[model samples]
Target: GGIITQTPKFLIGQEGQKLTLKCQQNFNHDTMYWYRQDSGKGLRLIYYSITENDLQKGDLSEGYDASREKKSSFSLTVTSAQKNEMAVFLCASSIMGFNYAEQFFGPGTRLTVL
Candidate 1:
Protein backbone atom coordinates (compact mmCIF):
# COMPACT_ATOMS: atom_id res chain seq x y z
CA GLY A 1 0.00 0.00 0.00
CA GLY A 2 1.96 2.95 -1.34
CA ILE A 3 0.97 6.47 -2.22
CA ILE A 4 1.62 9.04 -4.92
CA THR A 5 2.80 12.49 -3.96
CA GLN A 6 2.94 15.72 -5.93
CA THR A 7 4.64 18.85 -4.72
CA PRO A 8 3.19 22.36 -4.60
CA LYS A 9 -0.56 22.02 -4.78
CA PHE A 10 -0.76 25.42 -6.48
CA LEU A 11 1.70 27.35 -8.56
CA ILE A 12 1.85 30.92 -9.84
CA GLY A 13 4.20 31.74 -12.67
CA GLN A 14 5.14 34.66 -14.84
CA GLU A 15 4.84 34.55 -18.58
CA GLY A 16 7.75 32.81 -20.28
CA GLN A 17 9.10 31.56 -17.02
CA LYS A 18 10.42 28.08 -16.57
CA LEU A 19 8.50 26.11 -13.98
CA THR A 20 9.01 22.63 -12.66
CA LEU A 21 6.67 20.18 -11.02
CA LYS A 22 7.61 17.00 -9.22
CA CYS A 23 5.99 13.67 -8.49
CA GLN A 24 7.00 10.78 -6.31
CA GLN A 25 5.49 7.37 -5.76
CA ASN A 26 6.22 4.79 -3.15
CA PHE A 27 4.24 2.18 -5.07
CA ASN A 28 7.29 1.19 -7.12
CA HIS A 29 5.23 1.20 -10.27
CA ASP A 30 6.83 0.30 -13.54
CA THR A 31 5.34 3.18 -15.49
CA MET A 32 4.77 6.85 -14.70
CA TYR A 33 2.94 9.48 -16.72
CA TRP A 34 2.42 13.19 -16.78
CA TYR A 35 -0.79 14.71 -18.06
CA ARG A 36 -2.19 18.15 -18.55
CA GLN A 37 -5.84 18.97 -17.93
CA ASP A 38 -7.27 22.21 -19.14
CA SER A 39 -10.45 23.87 -17.94
CA GLY A 40 -12.82 21.68 -19.92
CA LYS A 41 -10.77 19.36 -22.02
CA GLY A 42 -9.73 15.77 -21.52
CA LEU A 43 -6.44 14.70 -20.04
CA ARG A 44 -3.62 15.09 -22.53
CA LEU A 45 -0.47 13.07 -22.10
CA ILE A 46 2.65 15.12 -21.73
CA TYR A 47 5.32 12.53 -21.01
CA TYR A 48 5.77 8.95 -19.87
CA SER A 49 8.53 6.78 -18.58
CA ILE A 50 8.67 3.03 -18.37
CA THR A 51 11.86 2.75 -16.44
CA GLU A 52 14.44 4.75 -14.64
CA ASN A 53 16.09 7.33 -16.90
CA ASP A 54 13.81 6.37 -19.74
CA LEU A 55 11.79 9.25 -21.14
CA GLN A 56 9.23 9.23 -23.90
CA LYS A 57 7.58 12.26 -25.39
CA GLY A 58 3.82 12.47 -25.51
CA ASP A 59 1.39 14.49 -27.59
CA LEU A 60 2.11 17.70 -25.68
CA SER A 61 5.81 17.20 -25.13
CA GLU A 62 6.85 20.28 -27.03
CA GLY A 63 7.94 23.24 -24.92
CA TYR A 64 8.33 20.93 -21.99
CA ASP A 65 10.98 18.71 -20.49
CA ALA A 66 10.63 15.55 -18.45
CA SER A 67 13.05 13.41 -16.52
CA ARG A 68 12.74 10.15 -14.71
CA GLU A 69 15.46 10.61 -12.16
CA LYS A 70 14.85 7.24 -10.56
CA LYS A 71 12.20 4.57 -10.22
CA SER A 72 10.44 6.47 -7.47
CA SER A 73 10.55 10.01 -8.84
CA PHE A 74 9.72 11.99 -11.95
CA SER A 75 9.85 15.63 -12.85
CA LEU A 76 8.33 17.87 -15.50
CA THR A 77 9.45 21.31 -16.50
CA VAL A 78 7.63 23.90 -18.55
CA THR A 79 10.36 25.24 -20.79
CA SER A 80 8.47 28.44 -21.50
CA ALA A 81 5.13 29.25 -20.03
CA GLN A 82 2.57 31.12 -22.09
CA LYS A 83 0.91 34.26 -20.88
CA ASN A 84 -2.42 33.80 -19.17
CA GLU A 85 -2.09 30.06 -19.31
CA MET A 86 -3.84 27.97 -16.77
CA ALA A 87 -3.94 24.21 -16.36
CA VAL A 88 -3.66 21.38 -13.90
CA PHE A 89 -0.73 19.02 -14.17
CA LEU A 90 -1.31 15.48 -13.05
CA CYS A 91 1.04 12.64 -12.32
CA ALA A 92 0.08 8.99 -12.47
CA SER A 93 1.72 5.65 -11.91
CA SER A 94 0.86 2.09 -12.84
CA ILE A 95 2.31 -1.35 -13.18
CA MET A 96 2.74 -1.66 -16.89
CA GLY A 97 3.70 -5.31 -16.99
CA PHE A 98 0.46 -6.43 -15.42
CA ASN A 99 -2.68 -6.91 -17.46
CA TYR A 100 -5.05 -5.45 -14.89
CA ALA A 101 -2.90 -2.61 -13.69
CA GLU A 102 -4.63 0.40 -12.23
CA GLN A 103 -3.25 3.89 -12.44
CA PHE A 104 -2.98 5.95 -9.30
CA PHE A 105 -3.09 9.72 -9.65
CA GLY A 106 -1.60 12.45 -7.55
CA PRO A 107 -3.60 15.39 -6.24
CA GLY A 108 -2.32 17.50 -9.12
CA THR A 109 -0.59 20.84 -9.35
CA ARG A 110 -2.61 23.82 -10.56
CA LEU A 111 -0.67 26.35 -12.58
CA THR A 112 -1.65 29.94 -13.19
CA VAL A 113 0.54 32.04 -15.40
CA LEU A 114 0.31 35.78 -15.31
Candidate 2:
Protein backbone atom coordinates (compact mmCIF):
# COMPACT_ATOMS: atom_id res chain seq x y z
CA GLY A 1 0.00 0.00 0.00
CA GLY A 2 1.04 3.61 -0.61
CA ILE A 3 0.08 7.00 0.66
CA ILE A 4 -0.34 10.54 -0.66
CA THR A 5 -0.20 13.58 1.55
CA GLN A 6 -1.13 17.23 1.08
CA THR A 7 -0.08 19.94 3.43
CA PRO A 8 -2.30 22.51 5.11
CA LYS A 9 -5.77 21.07 4.77
CA PHE A 10 -7.24 24.56 4.96
CA LEU A 11 -6.05 27.88 3.66
CA ILE A 12 -7.23 31.46 4.08
CA GLY A 13 -5.74 34.07 1.85
CA GLN A 14 -6.28 37.68 0.95
CA GLU A 15 -7.18 38.75 -2.54
CA GLY A 16 -4.26 39.07 -4.93
CA GLN A 17 -1.94 37.01 -2.80
CA LYS A 18 -0.04 34.04 -4.12
CA LEU A 19 -0.75 30.82 -2.29
CA THR A 20 1.17 27.61 -2.62
CA LEU A 21 0.27 23.99 -2.03
CA LYS A 22 2.33 20.83 -1.86
CA CYS A 23 1.67 17.19 -2.57
CA GLN A 24 3.75 14.09 -2.07
CA GLN A 25 3.20 10.48 -2.93
CA ASN A 26 4.92 7.22 -2.16
CA PHE A 27 3.21 5.18 -4.87
CA ASN A 28 5.95 5.66 -7.42
CA HIS A 29 3.42 6.81 -10.00
CA ASP A 30 4.64 8.71 -13.00
CA THR A 31 1.73 11.07 -13.50
CA MET A 32 0.58 13.69 -11.05
CA TYR A 33 -2.19 16.27 -11.36
CA TRP A 34 -3.74 19.28 -9.72
CA TYR A 35 -7.39 20.16 -10.02
CA ARG A 36 -9.73 22.81 -8.75
CA GLN A 37 -13.33 22.29 -7.67
CA ASP A 38 -15.56 25.26 -7.08
CA SER A 39 -18.82 25.07 -5.21
CA GLY A 40 -21.40 23.03 -7.09
CA LYS A 41 -18.98 22.73 -10.02
CA GLY A 42 -17.13 19.75 -11.33
CA LEU A 43 -13.41 19.25 -11.15
CA ARG A 44 -11.28 21.29 -13.51
CA LEU A 45 -7.72 20.43 -14.29
CA ILE A 46 -5.14 22.99 -13.35
CA TYR A 47 -1.88 21.26 -14.15
CA TYR A 48 -0.28 17.86 -14.62
CA SER A 49 3.19 16.45 -14.82
CA ILE A 50 4.00 13.22 -16.58
CA THR A 51 7.41 12.85 -15.01
CA GLU A 52 10.08 14.58 -13.07
CA ASN A 53 11.10 17.96 -14.45
CA ASP A 54 8.17 17.98 -16.83
CA LEU A 55 5.05 20.12 -16.72
CA GLN A 56 1.81 20.33 -18.68
CA LYS A 57 -0.72 23.08 -18.47
CA GLY A 58 -4.35 22.06 -18.26
CA ASP A 59 -7.48 23.95 -19.30
CA LEU A 60 -7.64 25.91 -16.07
CA SER A 61 -3.89 26.44 -15.72
CA GLU A 62 -4.06 30.13 -16.62
CA GLY A 63 -3.79 31.32 -13.03
CA TYR A 64 -1.40 28.72 -11.71
CA ASP A 65 2.12 27.38 -11.95
CA ALA A 66 3.12 23.81 -11.15
CA SER A 67 6.33 21.93 -10.64
CA ARG A 68 7.36 18.31 -10.44
CA GLU A 69 10.74 18.46 -8.83
CA LYS A 70 11.08 14.73 -8.34
CA LYS A 71 9.29 11.51 -9.05
CA SER A 72 7.37 11.55 -5.79
CA SER A 73 6.36 15.16 -5.29
CA PHE A 74 4.44 17.88 -7.09
CA SER A 75 3.61 21.41 -6.08
CA LEU A 76 1.35 24.21 -7.26
CA THR A 77 1.33 27.94 -6.81
CA VAL A 78 -1.70 30.14 -7.27
CA THR A 79 -0.55 33.12 -9.30
CA SER A 80 -3.07 35.47 -7.79
CA ALA A 81 -6.03 34.67 -5.61
CA GLN A 82 -9.29 36.44 -6.37
CA LYS A 83 -11.56 38.05 -3.81
CA ASN A 84 -14.53 36.02 -2.62
CA GLU A 85 -13.22 32.99 -4.45
CA MET A 86 -13.45 29.63 -2.77
CA ALA A 87 -12.33 26.36 -4.15
CA VAL A 88 -10.91 22.97 -3.24
CA PHE A 89 -7.59 21.93 -4.68
CA LEU A 90 -7.04 18.26 -5.18
CA CYS A 91 -3.89 16.33 -6.01
CA ALA A 92 -3.98 13.06 -7.82
CA SER A 93 -1.69 10.42 -9.26
CA SER A 94 -1.85 7.38 -11.48
CA ILE A 95 0.37 4.84 -13.10
CA MET A 96 2.05 5.78 -16.35
CA GLY A 97 1.38 4.50 -19.92
CA PHE A 98 -2.40 4.76 -19.92
CA ASN A 99 -4.20 8.01 -20.47
CA TYR A 100 -7.45 6.89 -18.92
CA ALA A 101 -6.05 5.27 -15.84
CA GLU A 102 -7.83 5.79 -12.56
CA GLN A 103 -6.32 8.41 -10.28
CA PHE A 104 -6.07 8.45 -6.51
CA PHE A 105 -6.86 11.74 -4.81
CA GLY A 106 -5.68 13.45 -1.69
CA PRO A 107 -7.96 14.75 1.06
CA GLY A 108 -7.94 18.14 -0.72
CA THR A 109 -6.99 21.60 0.42
CA ARG A 110 -9.82 24.05 0.73
CA LEU A 111 -9.01 27.67 -0.05
CA THR A 112 -10.97 30.77 0.82
CA VAL A 113 -9.98 34.19 -0.44
CA LEU A 114 -11.17 37.20 1.51
Candidate 3:
Protein backbone atom coordinates (compact mmCIF):
# COMPACT_ATOMS: atom_id res chain seq x y z
CA GLY A 1 0.00 0.00 0.00
CA GLY A 2 3.05 2.26 -0.02
CA ILE A 3 4.15 4.47 -2.90
CA ILE A 4 7.21 6.26 -4.22
CA THR A 5 7.38 10.03 -4.51
CA GLN A 6 9.70 12.29 -6.54
CA THR A 7 10.31 15.88 -5.60
CA PRO A 8 10.37 19.08 -7.69
CA LYS A 9 8.10 17.61 -10.36
CA PHE A 10 9.86 19.86 -12.87
CA LEU A 11 13.49 20.90 -13.14
CA ILE A 12 15.12 23.48 -15.37
CA GLY A 13 18.87 23.72 -15.70
CA GLN A 14 21.50 25.56 -17.64
CA GLU A 15 23.82 23.70 -19.95
CA GLY A 16 26.86 22.22 -18.19
CA GLN A 17 25.29 22.69 -14.80
CA LYS A 18 24.76 19.87 -12.36
CA LEU A 19 21.22 18.93 -11.45
CA THR A 20 20.04 16.79 -8.60
CA LEU A 21 16.79 14.84 -8.35
CA LYS A 22 15.22 13.34 -5.23
CA CYS A 23 13.02 10.38 -4.46
CA GLN A 24 11.38 8.84 -1.41
CA GLN A 25 9.55 5.59 -0.79
CA ASN A 26 7.43 4.23 2.04
CA PHE A 27 7.45 0.59 1.04
CA ASN A 28 10.19 -0.09 3.58
CA HIS A 29 12.03 -2.04 0.94
CA ASP A 30 15.77 -2.66 0.84
CA THR A 31 16.44 -2.21 -2.83
CA MET A 32 16.09 1.09 -4.65
CA TYR A 33 16.82 2.20 -8.20
CA TRP A 34 17.05 5.24 -10.47
CA TYR A 35 16.28 5.19 -14.14
CA ARG A 36 16.29 7.79 -16.89
CA GLN A 37 14.08 8.00 -19.96
CA ASP A 38 14.73 10.21 -22.95
CA SER A 39 12.23 11.05 -25.61
CA GLY A 40 11.32 8.09 -27.80
CA LYS A 41 13.65 5.89 -25.81
CA GLY A 42 13.10 3.21 -23.23
CA LEU A 43 14.10 3.64 -19.63
CA ARG A 44 17.77 3.17 -18.82
CA LEU A 45 19.04 2.24 -15.40
CA ILE A 46 21.28 4.95 -13.98
CA TYR A 47 21.83 3.66 -10.48
CA TYR A 48 20.66 1.14 -7.90
CA SER A 49 21.24 0.38 -4.26
CA ILE A 50 20.77 -3.01 -2.69
CA THR A 51 20.75 -1.52 0.78
CA GLU A 52 21.05 1.75 2.59
CA ASN A 53 24.31 3.62 1.97
CA ASP A 54 25.34 1.07 -0.61
CA LEU A 55 25.25 2.12 -4.22
CA GLN A 56 25.96 0.32 -7.48
CA LYS A 57 26.38 2.08 -10.78
CA GLY A 58 24.19 1.12 -13.68
CA ASP A 59 25.03 1.06 -17.39
CA LEU A 60 24.06 4.69 -17.75
CA SER A 61 25.72 5.80 -14.56
CA GLU A 62 28.65 7.46 -16.26
CA GLY A 63 27.26 10.98 -16.04
CA TYR A 64 25.49 10.83 -12.72
CA ASP A 65 25.78 10.24 -9.01
CA ALA A 66 23.49 8.54 -6.53
CA SER A 67 23.08 8.51 -2.80
CA ARG A 68 21.09 6.37 -0.40
CA GLU A 69 21.36 8.11 2.96
CA LYS A 70 18.79 5.58 4.19
CA LYS A 71 16.32 3.06 2.78
CA SER A 72 13.45 5.56 2.82
CA SER A 73 15.06 7.83 0.24
CA PHE A 74 17.45 7.99 -2.70
CA SER A 75 18.79 10.73 -4.94
CA LEU A 76 20.49 11.23 -8.32
CA THR A 77 22.57 13.99 -9.81
CA VAL A 78 23.16 14.73 -13.44
CA THR A 79 26.88 15.42 -13.87
CA SER A 80 26.52 17.95 -16.66
CA ALA A 81 23.29 19.15 -18.13
CA GLN A 82 23.38 19.06 -21.92
CA LYS A 83 22.08 21.89 -24.00
CA ASN A 84 18.36 21.73 -24.57
CA GLU A 85 18.35 18.30 -22.95
CA MET A 86 15.21 16.74 -21.54
CA ALA A 87 14.46 13.48 -19.81
CA VAL A 88 12.52 11.84 -17.04
CA PHE A 89 14.21 10.29 -14.05
CA LEU A 90 12.38 7.54 -12.22
CA CYS A 91 12.69 5.95 -8.81
CA ALA A 92 11.74 2.43 -7.93
CA SER A 93 11.93 -0.01 -5.04
CA SER A 94 11.69 -3.76 -4.58
CA ILE A 95 11.09 -5.94 -1.55
CA MET A 96 13.84 -8.43 -2.54
CA GLY A 97 11.43 -11.32 -2.69
CA PHE A 98 12.88 -14.68 -3.64
CA ASN A 99 13.61 -14.85 -7.36
CA TYR A 100 11.03 -12.30 -8.39
CA ALA A 101 10.62 -9.17 -6.35
CA GLU A 102 8.15 -6.66 -7.69
CA GLN A 103 9.33 -3.09 -7.95
CA PHE A 104 7.13 -0.01 -7.88
CA PHE A 105 8.04 3.21 -9.70
CA GLY A 106 7.45 6.85 -8.84
CA PRO A 107 5.97 9.24 -11.40
CA GLY A 108 9.34 10.83 -12.38
CA THR A 109 11.40 14.00 -12.26
CA ARG A 110 11.08 15.91 -15.49
CA LEU A 111 14.23 17.74 -16.53
CA THR A 112 14.99 20.32 -19.18
CA VAL A 113 18.32 21.97 -19.88
CA LEU A 114 18.23 25.31 -21.61
Provide backbone clash counts, one per model: 0, 0, 0
- Judging by lDDT against the true structure, name the best candidate: 1
**How do all the candidates rank in terms of TM-score, highest first?**
2, 1, 3
- Candidate 3, superposed: residue stretches over 4 Å from native: 97-99
Query: Can you write out model 2's per-residue Cα lDDT over 37-72, one digit (the tens) per residue?
Result: 988889999999999999998999998999899999
Q: Report RMSD (Å) for each prediction in the order shown.
A: 1.3, 0.9, 1.3
Query: In model 2, where do residues sit more than 4 Å from their true spots?
Result: none
- Candidate 3, run of 10 with poorest lDDT: 94-103
lDDT of 1 by residue, 1-114 (tens): 999999889999999999999999999898999999998898999999999999999999999999998999999999999999999999999988365778899999999999
Could you tell me the lDDT of residue 19 within candidate 2? Answer: 93
Please say which candidate is ahead in TM-score: 2 or 3. Answer: 2
> Tens digit of lDDT per residue, candidate 3, span 71-101?
8999999989999888999999998633588
lDDT of 3 at 91: 92
CA lDDT of each prediction against the hidden true structure: 0.94, 0.93, 0.92
Residue 111 miss distance in model 3 (angstroms):
0.4
Which residue runs does candidate 1 get wrong by more than 4 Å? 97-100
